[model samples]
Target: MLCGCVGLVWLYEGDVEVAVYLIWLALVFDFLDGFVARLLRVHSPMGKELDSLADLITFGVLPSFILYKMLQQQEVDAWVPYLAFLVAVFSAIRLAKFNIDENQQTVFIGLPTPANAIFISSLIFVDGSYPSLLSYPVLLIITILFSYLLVSPMELFALKFKDFGWKGNEVRFSFILFSALSLLFFLHLALPMIVMMYILLSFFVKIISTT
Candidate 1:
């Protein structure tokens, strides 16, 4: 919650990069919350619901706020900011879907909110060296696309390792290795690219598996 508060403040102050960094920290804490819960063998339905609430703030609202500010700066339209809120709305739906989804115990049926948040937050880099990426048209398309992805029924892979074997896990291993290479070579730009790669690779693997 503290991280969420700081992210809100930094975003309001127009320090978008710092706001994004805070979100990354929040993600770390988010992961640790589940890991710690499992370690202690304490599971509550309340805790599950509370975690979703927390995610709505950090992953959903924060990234949407980032887009809202960017839209204001770009002076696209008053309605564009409202369009940004769709991200939050769809993210909430995605969380709800995840809760009820038995198939998602091992994989996701849509873009995870955290991945969507990271992809959106990583765009602040465009504000610096790649300002072209912040054009009103591009941002609008991205806003619409990501909002759809949050709720789309496309299956996505989870990062969980089911076992030590590398045979059936080849796709997972490839994803990790390529993501690492992207970070090494592309730096911050690698983030959005990695998100795109994740979606594309999942689709490709699904097609191959079915065939």
Candidate 2:
């Protein structure tokens, strides 16, 4: 979470690249916190609450701030930039839901905050490469779309692996392979695409199972 705060500082400093890097650092800490807790078998209610709070800052608010900064750069209506806060608002609800919902043990009911954060934060690169592409309208649309996705009741597969067997882990392994190749081939541009691919693949798997 402190990394997230520092990311805000960097965002204010107009060093968006640094801000994004700090977000990635926060993601590392987020993963380690859960890993360490599971390793020690020390799960507490307070720890869970703290994790949600920290996630709110690091994944929720930080990514919104990035969007806010991006929207501010565009010559949009004054109220447009405020829409970015929708991500933070929905993220709070998402985290709250996750805390109380038992069904999310192995699958997410909606988009994960960290995944959404990564997708949003990576938009900086998109905006950098194609300034016109991230115009006010486009950014606003993305914000609204993802805000709804946060609580949209759509199921997304979690990347956990209890056993690395090919039968049950086909989707996970395929996604990981595609992600690796994507990063290798597309570099930073693959970040948002990877998230999109995750969503699409989840839906594809869902359809397959139903049929």
Candidate 3:
């Protein structure tokens, strides 16, 4: 609760970098809650429900707030900020569906909330490094494209360690390695490029796996 409140305050103050760090802290709490539950064998129905609610606020609401801040800096019309909220709406649906979807026990069928949060946070960081790219038209287009990715059916994203080793892991591992190098070399400027690589690589892997 403290982390969530701090994150909301950061968002309200337009301190996106601080908000991103707070969201990472929220993720840490999320990890510990599950770990503690399993460690003590105290997994109750209430715990599950509370975790979901916490996730909605930490991952869904906070990231949307950052996007809203980015859109506010744009010179576009009013509808642009509203459109950014779609990321939040889709995130909620994704989380709810994850809770009910049996197949996702092994792997995610869509973008996971943390990954979405990281992607959004990376954009905020990137904007500081590349202000010229955050024009109203470009930000609008990016919002629409990412919002589509949030709900896109054909995208097969990897969310597990197995998807990173041996046979078919070659491309995925290479992509991650290259992405790491890019980040080390270019810092936040590599964010969107790396994310694009992830999406495209995942799409190609899915295609090859199917055929």
Candidate with the greatest TM-score versus the true structure:
2
lDDT string for model 2 (1-211, tens) is 8988998998888899999999889889999988898789889899988998999998999999999988888888888899999999999999999999989988899999999999999998988888888878899999999999999898999988888799999999999999999999988889999999999999888888889
In candidate 3, stretches whose alpha carbon ends up further than 4 angstroms from where it belongs are 28-47, 155-157, 162-172
- Models 1 onward score TM values of 0.94, 0.97, 0.81
**What is the TM-score of candidate 2?**
0.97
Clashing pairs in 1: none
lDDT tens digits by residue: candidate 3, 1-211: 5676689897788677898888878878877776687679888667766777777778877888888888987776877788778877887887787777767654457766766776777787677777887777877787677666665665555534544346756775787798999989988667667777777777887788789
Score each candidate by Cα lDDT: 0.88, 0.92, 0.74
* Off by more than 4 A, model 2: none
On a 0 to 100 scale, what is the lDDT of residue 113 in model 1?
94
Cα error, candidate 2, residue 40 (Å): 2.6
lDDT at position 26, candidate 1: 89
Give each model's clash number. Answer: 0, 0, 0
**Every candidate's CA RMSD:** 1.4, 1.1, 3.0
- Tell me the deviation in Å of residue 105 in model 3: 2.7
lDDT, residue 153, candidate 1: 82
lDDT of 2: 0.92
